[model samples]
Target chain A: MLSKTIKTILTISAVTFFLSACSTTSTPDSATGSSTDGSSGTSGSSATTDGSGKNSVNDGVVAPTATVFYFDFDSSVLRTDSRALLDAHAAALKASPRSVRLEGHADERGTREYNIALGERRAQAVRAYLVSRGVTSPIEVVSYGEESPAVDASNEYAWQQNRRVEIK
Target chain B: MKKVMKFSIQVIVASFLFVSALSHAELTISITKGVDNPIVIGIVPFNYTGGGPLSENVAAIVSDDLERSGQFGPIAPENMLSYPSLPQDVVFRDWRLLGSEYLVIGDISPTASGYQLVYSLFDVVSQKTILFNQPIVVARDGLRDMAHHVSDKVYEAITGIRGAFSTEIIYVEHQKKARNYRLMRADMDGARPKVLVTSKQPLLSPSWSPDGQSVAYVSFESGRPAIYIQNLATGQREKMTNFKGLNSAPSWSPDGKKLALVLSKDGNPEIYTLDIATKRFTRVTKHFGIDTEPRWTADGKGIIFTSNRGGKPQIYSVVLADGYPQRLTFEGDYNARAQLTPDGKSIIMVHRRNKVFHIATQELATGTVRILTTETDLDESPSIAPNGASLIYATKRNGKGILASVSLDAGSKFALPSTSGDVREPSWSPYF
Candidate 1:
């Protein structure tokens, strides 16, 4: 019963988004860039552009994707692998002077408060790295804890994916 | 079996001594049994002086609190024959004739800067005053608390057991019909609920210190759950744990100097204790599985917690001094929230059997488990009353969380139905 209700709500949300898109103004540059970026594939477009080099926005200006940091269960320590991703996110934030939100999240296995704290730790870990990288973009950390999940499945893999800190 | 036999013999001997006390009003209850019928008592109208229109009527609130426990039935004021402030003035015969086993009479008058209450209890049949208390002043909007003090006096005098009526209860009440949750505290009978903290996310695992002055609970206020301790009287709070991993399931040390909690700050969730004075944390357990719900022994010598290290969530005792952990529950598939009874001989916990959660008491020495909750549903967080005879816990009814209490012996039971919204994580306070 709960699943059915959620499905209905999601369907309505999708319909609303589609209807609003029809009347919304679209920039011609973004429409062309989206198709070009799609053909190049998401993973292949990492040019590692230095601030000095300006890639042609008309060729394929990919929408900046968020960097996510994953932690060990019930732990706040940033893993070794997450360092690289955090560095990349920090570099991007430095290139773009605008502020970014660090969203903290946790898996569904533990208690709520525990997850909340874990989520905050994850966001703080990413923020600390960004600060070290000279990325001064205003960082605002918010923990979704276990309330918001990256995956809906109940399996271990899904839980691991859910327990993450996303730089948005 | 041998312990039961010895307990029965002890109960008989106690009863004999009670009866031999002659004119002395003595109550001898069986150790393993409780009176199915609540004790009937009358709280006569208290004599008041010059009209200032008091802030509250303590006697009425006391009467309602006792009645709600389902342990005492207070007679209506209209049924009383006479009001007496002192023991010598009470007409015991009149109460006995009215089918009242106990009678309470008191007077409220203006004191230094506040009001003073002088109350006494009389055992109807013995014609003797069971208890007499000196006048107490209403310190500061503390009349409701004074009522609980009166409740303790009457309960102790009648049941021969200390009363938890003076204690408070911590629970989570939903706002806007479960859309939001707030941590709250109230008198044990569920009166004067005051919200301590609130958030849109869920909150859980509220634990009270042995002194009953502070509470440690988990809140998702920061978008992630974190453990926080708040002083009930001052409303002052401090965040105890917000480690990167899980920081939850806090149980205060008996001395109130530390809190035994579960934290995955190091790795997977494990048991750890935080020194309140030094703000230092010491990991107590190292395991690959989940270790949560830590509780301290009355002596503070060891800790009990739920862990899946032994393949399932079972109760385990960890020695604080030596750091040696021993499994405590072998009879149940799942057991959590181990609360030591006041006597410290048995533990009351929620045990899962046949896929239903029930409150169960297990003797530490004999490993004999007695199921206390028999209804068909989820019953968790068993917190024993200060008296150790009854306990209050949270359970599901009509798809909404509510608080229900049961006498350990199954003699009497009552439900504290919430008028606000869903209530959960009920932590019974210790006697103040």
Candidate 2:
């Protein structure tokens, strides 16, 4: 009984450490510049001048919070904006040394089995990007095809969101 | 405590209704378009002489079956001049006056075991009895089946083609809110629905074995996709593929000895055949591009699949001996999910024209493409009947998935009744 209690405490502390490490390693986005540095005194303001004479408030060193990456219809080519976020995730995986799961999805179009292949292609693209970043953690990839949608609607916006790969 | 009890009662009642719905779900068909000059046939009500009230109106079912074929327009019983049960009672003059080219009469008599049906078909135009009294015996609960049997016989005698009224269809129904998916099997006319399997995750790509004894489908119940074959009679399931990647689109070979499926274990999706007896897989296609949705050719010597090797998805046929894939379709920017007709003369596929997905058929010898569906922009997963007369496919109606059927000539069209949730991936079974 005492050993089980100690194991539970150890698991809690380990999870806390892992989460903290993930937050610290993620890179902040330039578009949604969430300032992580409170010493800059620009937390409430929309715009602020930085050292490089730019109006962006973020230092561009904070961790990224976006894990879901979107793709075009019937294509698996990753967007340019997703590169920096994936790099942050790669950094987190390098620091924590944990297994990652990449779940791929597709919009509700085309034949179902073909969509399964398309989803896997997206997931494989993400896996390749992470691997190229020198991350050694084992990555498992699975594609749900067009079965599970991020949004239940059947519009263009929903389709864009549904064609994505989520990192868990 | 009282509120909890009330909620429990409601839950029990709701679950009971759900089970009942699964078992008794019947697809009501509405004919959108029919043949221009349908042959009119007059069917007299079958005279039933059983111990108690008959459970099913056998003659009505027969009339419905024949009418749904789009080749025969059954005359209503109320309009019939006489109710005939035998050849002697069928007045050729009366049917000719009613503008019916043919007449059908039947009688159901109670037997020691159950019942015996004696039916006859008469050619009103020729003024001769084409089919003599044909008798079929069935148990008490098989009135519907007995009706379908009579319809099949009459249909073949008239159209010279074996009827598919007695066949069955399998489809997947998904309840999005509950995250539940049920694989259902029903009669060809959508009656007596029975659930084959249910899962919390998604189920798709259901294919029937050639013998109609078992079905193969891809299920994600285990948090990942895997192919499974379930016996229709015993409800026993066997996991056919459990590879690290996709194991989907399991198409039974014509001989039923092997299954052609897609597996991505070797870096990307490719077609492979699994020997059922030996449990060995032989890679059929060796391509870096995505080759998937593999369907066996009618001859079973080659496989026709969807591949994006030429910058876009198109139908391709690869012979097992040569391992060389020859492209078959060239007219469409997107053509996938290729299913050959029973004659193997043409390929039926989901084709895109003007960015609208429709079911189209292409002649292999002439490269002539003919589009079949024009009602909806999202029609897909076309499964042809064994007789090659009609095909059923999934289409979206008001954002809800439903099944629709169209004759090969694109003359007759009908939509299956929409269930509570979405229904997709319809697979018409081979003749039982």
Candidate with maximal lDDT: 2
Q: Candidate 1: where are CA atoms >4 Å away?
A: A1-168, B1-35, B52-55, B68-71, B83-89, B176-179
lDDT of 2 by residue, B1-432 (tens): 011222222322332233233333466666666555667777787898776668777777787677668776677666678888988877788887777788989989998877899999998888988889999999978888998999899999999999999999999999787878999998887778888998998899999999999999999999999999999999999999999988889999999999999999999999999998899999998887889999888889999999999989999999998999999999989999999999999989999999889999998999999999998878889999999988999988888888989888887788876565788899999988
Evaluate model 2: give its TM-score.
0.86
Query: Best candidate per TM-score, number?
Result: 2
Q: Docking quality tier of candidate 2?
A: medium
TM-scores (chain A) of the candidates: 0.63, 0.63
Model 1 Cα lDDT, one tens digit per residue, A101-126: 88888875533444555576677766
Q: Ten-residue segment with the worst summed lDDT in candidate 2 chain B?
A: B1-10
**Residue lDDT tens for model 2, A5-52:** 234434453343233334332223221222221112122222221211
